[model samples]
Target chain A: MLEGISYTDTKKLTAIIKERFNLDFSNYAMSSFRHRVSVAISKFNLVSADSLIEKLLNDSYMFDLFLKEVSIYTTEMFRDPSAWKYISETVLPKLASQNEKINIWLPECTSGEDIYTIAIILKELGLTQKSNITASFISNSLMTSFSQGYEIKKMELNKSNYLRFNEKNDFSEYYSISNYKAFMNSDLLKNVSIEKFLIAPMINPTMVNLIIYRNKLIFFNSILQFDVLTMLTNSLECGGFLFIGAKENIINPEMRKHYKVISEHERIYKRISKN
Target chain B: MKNKIILIGGSAGSFSVVTQILTELPKNFRIPIVLCLHRLKHVRSGFAEALSLKSSNPVIEPYDKDRIEEGKIYIAPANYHLYIEAHKHFALSTEDSINHSRPSIDVTFVSTASVYKENVIAIILSGANNDGAYGIKRVKDLGGITIVQNPEECQVSTMPVSSIRIMKPDFILSSTEIIKYLIDINNKAFFGK
Candidate 1:
């Protein structure tokens, strides 16, 4: 079955972006990208992607908007509490007990929600001092937001989610309100590093203990998803854990061999071997 | 395309109508049927169970990424938008609501139009909003048979009226005529222009 004729226009539009801009979206699902480009086109009041692409190439501002449209920017803290609870209870404890300093990386930590959530988890578990957390994203637009220090936009929703995750204390203890934006406490940033990364064609700093890559895989097609998984696998040392979104699962039959299931329901898998 | 898949979407005053259809679709029916209804976001596991007791064919909320199977009825779960993959599987997303609906009618209808094209039969019934209007148009454009319940007979008229305005639907019948058409649609598929 083919995407409607306009979607064919969408494919040609993305091809132009990929070739001229050298941005690799070869991995994104066609259906997903078509829907995204359609939305972008609708925003510009353009009937076709052909018109949208012509504008994007000429106007840098349009390009930024295009980038924003393509990437799903969700600034959710502890979006799924059960997955967080599983990580806090089962995965983090083992890493904390192994060594004083645990090297944790969030490859697609869009905005700072993921990293800040982990920081709070470490603080509660008394592993804040012994954790070196690194967060990275492919999108420069989102990276700029992350570099400006963590700001919780949906403070009430985050508060509600945090309360549901663990209700022992007020979730507000983790952040201080400044200029109507919730800024994470300075203490949690002591052992953290944030950077923009190109995880696809290149990768660095192998030997990460755990990689939190939830839900981001849905943005890519199966081929890219498998390729990214393979890259993340090489980036981690033996026995390192890989956590995905609640709905995200290792689907490629051949890709399933490298990792062993930690929790099928949570979509958490552990690297069985470094190779 | 094997036996054609039937997709039904509705919002206000559709629960009883859906239950009636679900109860009538036979156990050995070769085709798979999927239903997307707009309901309260907090509902997780109740609607499917309620429908299952009266349904002749088994009815259950589809798990995210579950493979589609014939002879069963799949309901879009609450709070998340539903999508069908080209690989004939379901993928759920928490993307923001469209037309104030999460399991959005347009979202699923357009995707199904893209994937299944002529192999689908889609029906829009008794919704108070215009969620499924665009979807019905897409299905019609993609060469699938599109049906809208008669607005005069429906408890709510906004949905069918919107779709009917956008599309000269192949059939605009009451619930009884629609049910009878669905029961025989597999063997006597809608092929007329």
Candidate 2:
């Protein structure tokens, strides 16, 4: 039946984590988190949630690994290639003309796929010198790895997506292959700063021109989703852009008024001035 | 009886059967039908629209954390794993695909079985893969009603055969018989039979 762990186990584990680490998972959706716990149990060759909890209580490194495992990093470069194309063609040029220095935020930057994607876009638009990006990772360890460069696995799909994103663009020009890894060029990340997402304040007081918090909100419950969306809305400037995953939607009627739809099908919204 | 949900899973050749089934169900059918059919990753829209054409119920591809409503047909969106939460809401995951398919039949069926438990009525239909076999077996283990379309009547029998090999399902009915059974259940529910 694959009854790897029970919901009661999740409650117990989250309570312990809260008490020990002061990290609250009380609002995170239970189904996805529980499934991730099951995956962690098998991946670490632990017997059950009890052993996992023992490891977490005693060893600090295990907690980092646990966080990494639970966090979803299944995105590819230029996922929803059309959305990237739209940003390149329409979003960036308009922002560049209006602002002297465009600020962008990539919250939940798990593997830096979106970071590199947006960096490349900025470079192509000659906005790299005029742009600043704040990339937030789930863990400090992730920040270090993403800084080194993205390791290109599944080249075919990423390459195909890049091609689809812009047929006129050459995919190989963006990065160099060394020792079977595609290291993103250092020039692209010159203005990009990395920080740990959870350790920092959830609401960023610094306003940005664009926030691409895509595909990550599905991991949270509706209440948490609304809370996160509100924070993102606040982080955005009066006319800043916000993009989420194509399959996702802002369900709360109250939150809908904060942003006007730029592309309804693409899930792109532009912030409206608060009345 | 109050919190029952029906889950249907199919892969390769089950679309027409699903359309026919949805067409036959009356508009007043109260139980929510959740469909986890395999679809192309890149094609995001239009599946639910096409399904809604002949459906008596409103067919929708629900957003994450969307509440389950009666008389609506929920289709798992492309490129996401659909899970039924304990509070009767949908949870979408961008986690890596299972059995090489996102919107995987197994993921949806297993999650629904876990949440709904004995109140689930799970049906496995025509497909080329064994994706739904483990999930159907899970439903059976949890005392939920399990049905597999008779393999002989399927466009591709591998899915039904795979399921049958793992567990003894409650019924192996043809398409016509499956519709009849579902409508009969709806009739009984309406009449309090």
The TM-scores, one per candidate, come to: 0.85, 0.94
- The superposed Cα distance between candidate 1 and the true structure at residue B149, in angstroms, equals 4.7
**TM-score of candidate 1 relative to the true fold:** 0.85
True contacts kept of each: 0.10, 0.56
Q: Where's the lowest-lDDT run of ten residues in candidate 1 chain B?
A: B184-193
Cα lDDT for residue A121, candidate 2 = 86
Fnat of model 1, as a fraction: 0.10
In model 2, residue pairs whose N, Cα or C atoms come closer than 3 Å (at least 3 residues apart or on different chains), thus clashing, are none
Per-residue CA lDDT of candidate 2, range A7-70, in tens? 8888899999999988878778777778888988999999889999999999978988998888
| Candidate 1 residue-wise lDDT, A24-57, digit = tens | 7766655656677777777778877677878978
